[model samples]
Target: MFHLKKINKEKSDYYFMSGFTWLMGYLMIKCEQQKYRMMKIQKLYLFNLLCCLSTCTGLRGLISLEHKVYILEPMEEGNTHRLYRGEHLKLTQGTCGHGHNISYPTQMTNTTGHKRDAQSSTKHVELIIVADNREYQKQGKDVEKVKQRLAEIANYVDKFYRSLNIRVALVGLEVWSDGDKCSITQDPFTSLHEFLDWRKLKLLPQRPHDNAQLISGVYFQGTTIGMAPIMSMCTAEQSGGIVMDHSDNPLGAAVTLAHELGHNFGMNHDTPERGCGCRATVDRGGCIMTPSTGYPFPTVFSTCSKKDLAASLEKGVGMCLFNMPEVKVLYGGQKCGNGYVEEGEQCDCGDVEECLNPCCNASTCTLKQEAVCAHGQCCEDCQLKPAGTPCRESSNSCDLPEFCTGADPHCPANVYLHDGNACQGVDGHCYNGICQTHEQQCITLWGQGAKPAPGICFERVNSAGDPYGNCGKDAKGSFAKCEARDAKCGKMQCQGGANRPVIGTNAVSIETNIPLQEGGRILCRGTHVYLGDDMPDPGLVLTGTKCGENMMCINRQCQNISVLGVHDCSAKCSGHGVCNNNMNCHCESLWAPPFCDKAGFGGSMDSGPMRPTDSSGVTVGILVAFLCLLGVGIIVCFKRKTLLSLFFSNKNSTIEKLRKTLRIFFFCKSKKIKPILRPFIFFDIETMIKHDDN
Candidate 1:
């Protein structure tokens, strides 16, 4: 949809119309059953229109979700510190680490059944970036652009999984080797076999479900830095395993594949401690897999890390629980172990609780019935404390009388007036059960303590007075608002500014509202040399990021590029060159210029054009110039006569005769109608009828 804004009578009034001629064409391919697809397109258009609308309306609040991946040469994709977002991407783009995420505006419509299916089957792999691309190269595809290609794959993958009810996984295929031996062209079997070996797969760890499907795969086919800029191949779903060149660092390929493979199994980040390499803590940031930035820290697992891993694995790849050898060993092939079936161990319900346990998680306990009283005293007395009384013994409040076991009273064992078995101080907090000081909170968008700023949380909003970041709600991730008190690398400062490009040097790829290709190279302060369609009529070179979805392409340019005229002549002509949406254009009459640029010429010569002829053949065909001049007296009498003063010339007399014949015939009837009558003087109509030869 394209929109026009008018400051109507002092207030703004905006009008929206379909800007894309192609949209009309697309709509014609109508499949009523495919409402989801239509809705998505509509949403995308509306979203685009809204951006313009907001700018015109002066509305401040707007939200945008951008999916971007960086195809890093030496490193693996998306860096682990970038934790799995846990939000399913609607689309993906490009490959390797560098690709845009795909979210088609078209897939917004969902029938109830379709929605259910999507929910049941497609769970989000927060860590695995999914980008989309939608083009088939006329020339061979440029597979070297790992990021570009991956984005395309993401789109397809997202659409495929949207309506599926089965659990889907992204598979990463990077090669690896063993024991001080590393050659590239990473082998999946050699590298990945160790991480998720059949042995590990067979140990049933958690709840089991049977919905599973492969969403995507990643492999390496391109360059790896120093060799060439074209360095990788990535699937939109981040599942494409790595296929490294022998010269490439095989370990990097392996890890990359491991990252994507983990996504398939519902792993958000590679390391579970929220950060990587042993600085294990709930809040300490590490690898993206662990919710932290610092990885390569030495130990991969810690007491706190193991527990988190057990839980995540159990939840995401619950099907793996049945992959345990015990389940398989006893029951044909079940991964989960225990006792109760025809196997060595049964009661899987119990072992499942333990296998999934790690330092981060509390261990599950078995249930048993016991006497209410002991030794004639209240058996409950053996339990120590009563259930209702609060225990002030510990700050955790776990020692509350209700849970008091005289044998052991620890922090969390008691209760408090708050959640997380703890409370926040004047400037402290246990956000989502994690503790942080007031200074930390102040640095956060939410900040800490009482109103840091007024009508806001921490500071005044940028440009627009919108409530900045998180006041009571969450603020935008990956960006923070700025503060005056901050300096380079100081507190409360926006990281890289809110508008920096996500990958590399914060330089954004341009999106044009110009007459050009969607994904082509465009340079600032210069016009793109079009390969084919380049019209010379000068117009502003579009210099921006992406044309709005609602805009249409006209003569290789965007349709909204028009004068402030009342109607969109070009836009209307976009469908049919003659008529515009406002209903005006003379297509048949238009000649040299654009058909819609001006009104058509009209005349009252109702079905009329008099034929004219020359009689030069009879007057001057055989005569010399002098002779022809001598015949000027006759020429003057007859405008139809012709004479060539320089050279004798002739005109066909037959044409002249034909013209005269037509002229007389048409002139008689046209000037005035004359009724035709028979020569009745001889006989009246009645007499003639009576006298007719019978």
Candidate 2:
């Protein structure tokens, strides 16, 4: 019976071994199949990636080739083209009507009462280009061709603005193939008004962009090819321009578009009197802001344009330009050289030739090994800056500061006071991120000591519907009289400044003496600037100027600031914060965001935390985890005789292994290695288990 039992046990052991072997073989086969399948998927993925990259490269090359061919094509012979002189040219000659002289203050401080150093930062303009029906037809009724032309024009403008530390990113393109969205006419003034109104009412609501420009095929009256409001960038009322496609070559239209865009950026004509330095001579196109544009379209901006941009930025003229545009909305297909970091790209420092960043691999648009970041003010030494590090300081009263998050390389988008919020250090309220007051406008037109005149001046002067005294021009290009309530929203009347309007030589002073019932006469000084028929009169009151205690101007009407509902937005802030342009509560440093009632790091949801994360807790957690693991290993060794014996047999070896493992763990912790690499330490534990099993 004993012999039979022994034989049965042996057979059972043999069957168990066979079953184990079969299971092992099956697992190996399955693993091999999985490995083969994974390899095939990897190969297919690589092939698809290569094809996609090739397609993008081919499309970009085709576009470039088309652009080169079009540029090389000569202008139509015997066209007898009239001299393309823009009306803004009169600015240099002082021959046009009164022009607003935008003088830079001696002190380089912004309206927010802070020093401005905008040169150290870059600004981006999210631009949308629209083609009128006539322009679409001119391009052979090809929507794609019209889009290409407009894109090329935007590219040229972007190139011109690069020197000013500004980027013009084309976000959208609209081809008015069916018809013009707004009125287009030979009268440049009426056309500009209509286009701006349409842009504010229609385009702005549908597509959010920093600015829009209309490229038209219709010829403007006289020598005007383009017109834009000066120093009106990012404003809802006048942050747009109209450009006439006067030349078959897109470069000519690009130059005119750049000039009009410059006007929006607060740049004036590069007249000889400004003593502006131009690297490109007249034969090669003197400067982009030159009043007259002819052959060899100007590609470079003059020193004056750069200065104007800086001054405008300091004064918060282009407040919205401080934020980067959404790369996904960019018009052109993704390219490595476009400077925007798109999906699948770790970093982008511009084209390969222009890339000078040590942390970035420009060709592949990826960060170099060990680099966490390569761009933005919040990234330094290839690492993210600590939270609460100030990235963008408030530029003006309405502007808000942005801080680093310690998790992201880029700074947050800009924020500002809610519209209708009370302006800081000024009597007026915020509108479109600007604090416009009558006194401020007076100072801009006249020199120092300029102040808004008494009520009588505005009441009497704006009543007449003439060029010298009017609310603004009507749709028919005729002056419109201002009602009694809308008087302050019309032509600005001032007192005590330069003897004549300091704006320009063409500006004529209109003095009115209103005799009071008591006796003495009060002198009212008003300016009439003949800025040509196309441009809006700078002598008129600005759109956001305060008309009364709680009133502001809107479309030549005095409206209550409460229409913006700023009070309701502020009430949610719990008095510990202020309402930002996004309508979120920007909490104080000690309070949390979304609402300010919570006690935590400050800043709005749009911005980052106002304080750095605590590191002591992380250190403590790591130490505790290490202790727990050590305790578990000790307990396992005590509970298992095999493991305990193994440790006793090779004490020196075991100690040495433990030392090495600990060293690796400490090193990884010190370097802040990612969690994926932490599993490597467990291999040491596995080796010990294998030794015990053996």
Candidate 3:
């Protein structure tokens, strides 16, 4: 009941060969079904054998010609961006008091994903800072001083966030003053929470897709600063907003804002109870999350706090701070081939030419000397050669045999013998790889001994390798070795040596060399350090009020000094177009330049999907043909037994044999192959069988 299955034309490039085998098998089966069993069976077996041979030959041809290589296409614009969780991280800020609104310097701007800061990480955080006009007017603070203070605080916070690689931008700024007695006294902290819920103000758009965060700031000049809730309502909370007392100490205010934002990002207070506490004092320096502000300002966060922050950001709890559109950070993982030698990379030869290391393989990013060469010869080929293999030192050098001794055999760089090596060229001694006199060897090792000492010459030694003979004793004496542990120590690294002090522990003493001091001891626990009784207030050490006119204060460091003049269009574009350094307006397609004052129906035209070139088309066609041939072979195998039986049946007369022969010939000819005389030979056999039966 078996029947020939349909072949896939696209993959049937060997259809003619498969058809020929099927025909031969059919004829053999027919021969086996005759009354003369012995003779017919022998002929059938012979015919099947021939078919198998032909099939194997045809299969070999198909396999040899069917392979193809796929070329990678260039990446399209915005395609990689789509791989991110979202397009942008939006941070909405609400400020209290109006006279002087805190504005961030252009250096703190976050229009794109990457942040340029000391942290050396990349990412973006959209910022929208607004002032609550009612609270500001009610407080009635000096506008100029308040504005200056707010700017300082804003600038500080911007730097702090940037250190975490979260670019900060003040995208929205407004004054809200139309309410009744919405006084600063009405608990600005809790009131700010309500302000976030006030949908009518609509100062910022509520786009959950943007992964936004809301932070609010309050300032009261004469009012006493007291305990307040700097709440960050995260996944575990119903709402989120930070309320801070921003009167004096801009540095303190910035720290407070960061602390509250940590809460929203799902970080708990890092106090003694939570496993990391300050050794200097029980109340302070455990982290930015310390319940009480023992010091006016703390510049560092504890290890636990940083760990929690990293986790929060990784878990996507801190809205817009991590994994947002255009933001790249450690959480996103490192990408190879950026040309920079980053973590987890052994080598990065942007183009292949940069790789020149002897044992390194640039293309595969691995070592291949062991696999490619024998013990003594250089790795010039991917096959093992025996010891004493002939080699050349260089293109200009005379040929020499390789010295096969180490794990990887290589030719000696110098022609002369080394220590313990047999001398050559009528010399019985050697020193520093050169043939030497008996006195020279004694001078090199024993400093010109009265008599040349026996076996005194030893190989020169170094930290990385053992010497040929006893040379010296260990220098550092006995000391317990501490394993290297990863820890955040500002710009310092904890690499487990005498000078590399361990950080994030209960007690450690490190020598400090900051300006104004010759040298002093810094005793620290977690991120907080102890100040001596005679020492000045810690606030001065952590905060700085001065910076170059063109620079901004970042973590007490002056940075963001532009290499070139900046071109800003805040006065012209009105937010429609970005001004380039050349002072030219780069407007959106829908708006015209010159401040983007005019709107028009203009945008990009959509083109159809990309199509392959003619060469690619040809490649695809070849692949299709190969597939078709494979499909046909599979189909032929499926009905092989049945076709053989039908052809060998006694009822398959001469006329039926002729018909089958004609059909197979026609099929083969249609496939664009020269018709073989095998079908006619089969007809002749059929005729002979018929005559014998008569």
lDDT to native, each model: 0.23, 0.72, 0.32
Question: Candidate 3 regions off by >4 Å?
Answer: 1-123, 138-148, 177-185, 188-190, 199-201, 206-239, 277-286, 294-296, 322-622, 626-694
For residues 429-476, could you state the per-residue lDDT of candidate 3 as single tens digits? 222222223322222212222222121111111111121111111222
The local distance difference test score of model 1 is 0.23
**TM-score of every model?**
0.20, 0.75, 0.30
Which structure is stronger by TM-score: 1 or 3?
3
Candidate 2 Cα deviation (angstroms), residue 549 = 1.5
Q: What is the C-alpha RMSD of each candidate to the true structure, in Å?
A: 34.9, 20.6, 37.4
Q: Mind giving the per-residue lDDT tens digits that candidate 2 earns over 1-694?
A: 0010111331121111111111110000011112210000011211101100111101110011111111222123331112222221222111111133444443333265554467778889999999999999899998866876787677767776887888999999999999998999877778888899999999999999999999999887667778888888998889988888887656677778888888898888888777899977776558777778664446678888888878777777887877788988887656564688898889888755467999999768999999999999899999999888888877778878899988888889888888887775658878877788888788877778999999988999899988878899776678999999999999999998888777766678988888989999998888887666767787888777679988989889899978888889999999999999898999998899999999977899987777636657867989977865664454345434433454576765665656554555565556564323335445656676567567
- Model 1 Cα displacement at 469 (Å)? 8.2
Best by lDDT: 2
Q: Number of clashes in model 2?
A: 5
Best by TM-score: 2
Q: Order the candidates by lDDT, highest first.
A: 2, 3, 1
Give me the overall lDDT of model 2: 0.72
